[model samples]
Target: MEGRLVLALILGVCTAIPCHAYYSPSKPYVPPTEKVTQLHFFLHDTVSGKDPTAVLVARPNFTTAFNNTPIPFGSVFATDDPLTVGPNLTSGVIGNAQGLWASTGQDVLNLVVYWDFGFTQGKFNGSSFSMFSRNTITQTEREAAVVGGRGEFRMAKGFAKLKTYFADFSTADAIMECNVTLIHY
Candidate 1:
């Protein structure tokens, strides 16, 4: 009977021991506040002029290009078009939209694009932001996602709304106005 009581007491004492050395609670982490910036500009793309800003870089098979549809599928073009302050080319030059765009639609007019806006003469000079999007050219308005950026727009995430300011089907020249809103440091 005495041995049983001693064993019970020993067990009870062992169970009451503290375990701070093996486990410690952690504090919650908080992220820093971010700021937002809005930018407006225009992009001029010329594919038929002597000094065309956009050039045909790739195309699909010959049979595919001459398909029943008027629109060519899998046609890729590289562009280093100018970004201006206004819809007109004579407006202030701010940046260049350097990237590639591809016609992905087989029936209608749809283009998948990736562009980098490299600023030159502005408050965000030397800074650059990137965007990737699928634009339905038949529509009046188009939107693209601003994936990333560098310099003043570091870690930028946002969207850009583009409207066709001018277009010449005969010459394959277009001017688009872009309104961009983004969040950054």
Candidate 2:
């Protein structure tokens, strides 16, 4: 009887201790290894030109104040904005920021964004990093998470900081500077 009780207690204690889900009992556990890299670029978003980079895709009809606010709640925009080496649009295009943004706040420019910065013309060609964030947009800066990626950025994870370089209210256009750093293979 004491032996039976002792065995039950040992089993209970073993189950209570946590074990990593990815770890296997048959194989030795080794930490994942990766390399780090940094990228600097600028994204140009234009709404007024004949060739617009970002456009309104969806808008909530239920919101009575939709037309009153610059960026009404529930409004969604899709973007294929060009990523340039410099803040100016005339600069060389390195890649494109393919993303979607939805205005989630009633007052402020708060947005939920899913963006993929795909590099095409540079050394990081064919590689991309994705970010999903609840961003509170400001005139100064904000940050978003680089969730995961593929190609040269396989298993990538990091953060991207965006600083507003220029904003033209009349045309509803903006130039944002992005600095991305990530750890990947």
- State TM-scores per candidate: 0.78, 0.79
Per-residue accuracy of model 1 over 29-144 as CA lDDT, tens digit each:
67657879999899999888589999988877753642543336888899999999988889888989999998888667688989999999968999999999897777779888
lDDT of the candidates, in the order given? 0.85, 0.85
Reference-based lDDT, residue 119, model 1:
98
Predicted candidate 2 versus true structure: per-residue lDDT over 86-176, tens digit per residue: 9887899998989898888776667798989899986889999998987776547888899999889989999988898998755658888
> Which residue runs of candidate 2 sit more than 4 Å off their true CA positions?
1-32
